[model samples]
Structures are given as structure tokens and as C-alpha cells.
Target: MTSEEFGAAPTRGRRLRTVVVFHLADVTGPAKSLRPRLEAIARRGGGLDVLAPAEGSLAGAYGDLGTVCALPYASLTVPRTPREAARAVRSFARDVGLFRRELHRRRPNVVVVVTTALPAALIAARLEHLPTVVYVGETFPSRATDGTVRWLGGRVIARLCEALADRLVCCSETVARQFVRLGSTVTIYPGISRIYAEGDRAGFRARYGLEAASPVIAVVGNLTAGRGQDTAVRALALIRERLPGAQLVIAGLPHPRPIDEAFAASVHDLASELGVERSVVFTGFVERVADVYAAADVVVNPARFDEPFGRVALEALTAGRPVVASAVGAIPEVLRDGRDVLLVPRDDPVALAEAVSRLVEDPALRDRLVAEGSRRVESEFGEEAGIEAFEGVIADVLEQRSNGPRSRSSSPG
Candidate 1:
């Protein structure tokens, strides 16, 4: 799609009624990143109705924006057993009926599905002939034990969005590449607040009980195996051997899933086994995550999977910290190996440790990476730019719907 297509001004003097659907009820990264976009919509004389699985922090945060409703929906999952397959079918059918009823009651002009995990909303919106936009940020699992099943399920969801939704808004080019056949795929990177650069380092260190002279390495993300918190913990053991006062701060809470919970426990156990428990601090669900960045000498993102977009790296860079991240997915796309950030092999504790240690020892190198990384974020991924792109997508989708059927000459057969 050309810039002209999306740059068309929205119809003036008409309030656009929009309904946004989300799969999760918690205040997740995607939900937080989307807040500014939703606020922009409201500012543009748009009516907002937010839907999620249940009423929780997400609903409460968006209450002022518009009406917040609890609508339980089923997400697509790879079924490994016969029982799971049967359950998935039943849940999907029930969710489609529920979503259809909700859409009918609301009668929105546009339907926005926040994640590809939930396809019931898209199907329902297609049936209602409402313009739909699916925002995809997730990189489906393709390297796990059930890689084949998970990969197949992800392709099915991708095809569903391509066939049903009027537009697909991807968080990164890495994600957009997966929907190569979708004509309306647009990449809009999520933005970070400038507040990250303004955190109080002294206050954060004081509150966390860390000495001013100690070297701190922070790994910020939910506690999960895919996030590679265990790798960081093991790397901490090696890091402490050189810099005895080095501390690893594991930030964020465990997701409310059984696999994530177990992974979190395993990370703690691994820290204990490596005798780095005392040197590692676990701050569960930090309200002000910038503080963790402020208190850190270096931030490590040792992700084990193909991260769709490494938001943690951006946040760290925006906070003026040098990042040591895995060379996976969009990380390398946005950050350079030695210039903006250090890229290490995935799940390699030795490389991660070595990179962190280098940052600790070389102040000039750290300053260079921090400067370059922050500059890139300011120029390309600011909040205003993201909001503009998002609003453009919504406007374009609405315009197309108003003009009747869209031209399929640009789409693949």
C-alpha cells in the first residue's frame, strides 16, 4: 500500500463508532502500547467500546476512554490430544455465537481485533459486513516440541485474517512478512514514552537496596522460558565471577498460565542451583518499569524464540541503557550488533555474560550504544508517529468500506 492510500483524511464531522476486541483481560504490553491509539481515536470524534475476556486492569484502565465490556472469547490453540481438539471446537463455536451477539447489539461501524490469537471476532465481523482490522504482534511458536502443530495453527489464523479482516496492522516487518499474501498488511512499530529517559536512578537504586557502586544487569519481561530469564540467571553466575558485585534484576511477573508459571518456578530454581539467588533480585510486576532501567548498568534480552518485536530492548535504549539481546527476529532489524546494541546468540549464557561484562568495563562503548539507540527511538518510534500510522489504518479501512467492495487486483490469488 502506498502512503497516499493511507494518508487520505478521515471524513469530517462524523463520529466513527469502533469496537475493539482483545483476547486477554490483563494489562499486557500490547494493551499498554495501544492506549495512545485508542485515546487518539476518541479525540478524533470516535466512539470506543472495548471488549476483553473479563473485567480487570485492562478494562479499568480504558474505562474513561469509552464503554468497557467483558466478553469471554476463545483463542486458537494447538491441540495435542483428542480431548483438547474436541474442547477447542466447542469453545470456538460458543465464542463465535457470543461475539456475533455482542456485535449485533453494539452495531459498530468498525471492528478491531487486537491480536490474531482471537479469530472469532473477525469471523463475526465478516458475517456482519463490518470493516475489521486485526492487529498482529505475536510470533507464533515454530521451534517448540509441538512446532509442527503450532506452525500449522498459526498459518490457519493468518489465512483467516487475510480472508476476513479488511486490514492487518503488524507491529513489525518481521510479523508482516508472515502475511505476504495479505494486500492490506501495514507495519506500525509500537512506541515508547519519553518518560523512560527521565527515570530517577538514585531513587531507584535506593528503593531497591542496591549500592551506588554495584553493577546491575536488568532483564525486563514476564518470567517465561521463551523470554530466557534462566539464561540471564546462569549468565549472572558467570558475570559475578568477574564483577563480584554484579547483580541481576529479573523484572516483571509470571503470566497467569500454567506453562509460564512453571517456567517462572524453574527460573527461580535455576538461580538457586547456580548459587546466584542472593545476587539475583526478582521484582514481580513493576508498576514503574523505567526505574528498573534507571537502576541498571546494562539490560539483557536473551530471548529463546523469534521475538516478533523486542519492546524491552527499545524501552532499555530509550532509558539510556546499553542492551545485550539475542540476534532474533526484529531485534537485529532495529538494532545493530555493535553500534546501537550488542547482539548475541540466542540462549547462550556465556555470550550474554561476556557482552554484559564488556558493557560494564567499557564506558565509552556503552555511551555510544546508548546515544545511537536513543536517537533511533526518538526519530522513528515516537508516540506521535505510531498514533498517526494507527489512525491512518483505521481511517483507510473505514473509507474503503464506505466505497463498497475493495479492489482485489493487488491481492494474491
Candidate 2:
């Protein structure tokens, strides 16, 4: 469909209300990333109908955005055993009937689902003969010790996304490649906020008691084994030999999962064992990630496993700092090696340290990387892309439906 077709949607006398459903609790990473796009939908004489599970901190997560209501999905905040997972699935099936009733009552033009919630939402939207767009982030679950049940469940969810959804939008090209079964897919980077693009470097350093040239190296994200914080600490042990006063900053919060907290403690213990304990700082769960990026001379996203998108690397680049990251998953698709970012081998502390050292020693190299990174981030991942892409998909679906009724078995092209 042409871009011009997007703006042709009717929104004069009456507004087009949009409904979005996701199985989530609280305003975590995903909520924060897509909230801007939701606001944009609201700005175009449209409304946001948020349908999430009523359990946990969801009430606070969506706080006064659109018309918030509850769907009977499973709660992650509660103890999640295999039995609980099954119960949640059964509950979701039950909720589908209620949610379909809500859609009919609300009569939204389209439905948008944020990832795995697609199965139930798609089924409900189909009952109402409404088109759906599924926003896919991680195709598979990421955990250090992912039991077979969760992994198998993720596969089931992925298949449902393929079989039921009309259009599947991916968070990055990597995700698009891994999940292009039957639906037409598009890539839209959930760009970082303006605070990262314009944070105070000097002030952030001061707030953390960092000297003007202490050479801070930062790793930002949840404390997890797959994220590779331990590797960052080992790299710091290597970084300190060259720049003795160099520090490693770990900025993130641990999840309620025991493994997540245990992983955080393991990272700290590794630092001590390496005799770089004093140089490493663990800033637990700071909301201000841009500030963490600001305090760093070099930022690292050393993900051991492939990720859908390395958001921390994006934030670091937005903060105008040189970034060193592993060439895993969709990271290379977003940031180029030796251009916007420096890519290293996964789980190699020696390689990680060498890359960080190069940025520290070579001021000219850092400047080259920073300039390229800023330009790439601006042109490619601009503020409006997320909202615009979503709007275009919704518009396309509406326009197609206006042309004729879609066959129930017809796959999206």
C-alpha cells in the first residue's frame, strides 16, 4: 500500500477508536517503549482501548491512558509453576469470550496486540471480523535456565501468531527473519526517548561521584545470565590494568525470579574474585537509564544469547557514547560494526576488553563512532517511525476491508 493511503482514513466528525491488548503487569520495558505510539494514535482523533490482565501492577502501569480494562490473563507476578502456566492458558481461553463481547460493545475499527498475547486477542478480533496487527519482539523466550515447558509454550505462541494474525510487525529485522511464517511483516525500531539523546554527561558523572576522566564503562539492562553482566565485570578486570582507575557500572533491576537475583549476585561475586570489586558499581534498578549512559565513556551490550533488539545499545548511541556490543541477534541489523557500534565475540572477555580499550585510548576513533551513531539513530530510528508505522498498518487494514470482505483463510501478504 502507498504511504498516501495512510492519511486518507476518515477522522473528521467522528474519531476512530483503536483497541490494544497485551498480557502484562506494570509499566516495564515494553510498556514504556510503546506508550509513545499509543499517545500518537490518540492524537490522530483516535482513542486507545487498553485491555490487559487486571492482576498485578497493571493499574499503575497504564495510569490514565485511554479506557483501561481487565482481561482474564495469567499474572507473572504470582508464582509461576507449570500448573500456573496451564491455568493461565485456560483462563485466557475463557477471557476470549468476554473480550470478544467487549470488542463488539466497543466496536473498534482494528485490534493491535503487543506480542504473545496475539493468540487470544486474534481469536477474539476474528470473532468480531476485525483485522489485527501483532507487534512481535522476542519470538522465543530468553532465560538462562528456561525449562522445556516455557520454551515449548513460546513455540506454541509463535505458531499462533503466524496462523491467526493478519499482519505481524517485528521490533527489528532479526526478529522479522526468525518469524515470517504466513503474515506480512514489517520492522519498526522502538526508538529511545529524547532524554537519552540529550542527557547531561558531566552532571551524570558528578551524581555518581565519577571523575571527569575516570573512564566509566557501563552495562544497562535487567540482571540476567543471558545479558552477560558477568562478562562485563571480567572485561572490567581487564580494563583496569590499562586504565587503573576505570570503573564498571551495572545499572538494572532484578526480576522477581530467583535466577535473576542469583545472577546479579554472581556478577558481584565475579567482580570481587577478579579483584576489581572496588572499581565495579552495581546500581540496582535505576529508572534513569539515560543518566547511566551519560556517565559512561563507553557502553557495552554483551548479550550472550541472541536478542530481538539491544535497546541498551540504542540508548547508549542516543546518549552519544561509543558502544561495544556482541554481534548477536538483530543487533548487527540495527547498528553496523566499526561504524555506529563496535561488535565483539560473545562471552569473550578478552575481546570485549580489547574493544573497550580501543575506544578509551583512541579519542579520534570514539568521536568518529559517536558522530556516525548519532546520525544513524536520527535518520533510521526517528521519534515518529514507531507511531507512523503502526498507523500505516492500521490504515492499510481498514482500507483493505473497505475494498471487500477478507476471506477467513486468506493469509496476509
How many residue pairs clash in all the candidates, one count each?
0, 1
Task: Residues 85-133, candidate 1: write the lDDT tens digits.
Answer: 9999999888887888787777676788999988888877776667899
**Per-model lDDT:** 0.84, 0.76
Which residue segments of model 2 deviate by more than 4 Å? 1-14, 26-29, 54-65, 68-72, 75-89, 101-106, 141-153, 403-413
lDDT of 1 at 334: 74
lDDT of 2 by residue, 1-413 (tens): 22233224443223467788876654555666678877777666557788876654555556566778876664222226779768766777776777677777776767888866547678878877777788777747544446666666666676777777778878888888766474478777886776786666788777777778799999888788988999999999888888998998888867667988899888888888999888887877666678788788999998987878887787788788999999998888889999889999999999999999999999999999999988888888776777777667766667666555543322221
lDDT of 2: 0.76
Candidate 1 Cα errors over 4 Å, as ranges:
1-14, 143-146, 405-413
Q: Flag clash pairs in model 2.
A: 252-285
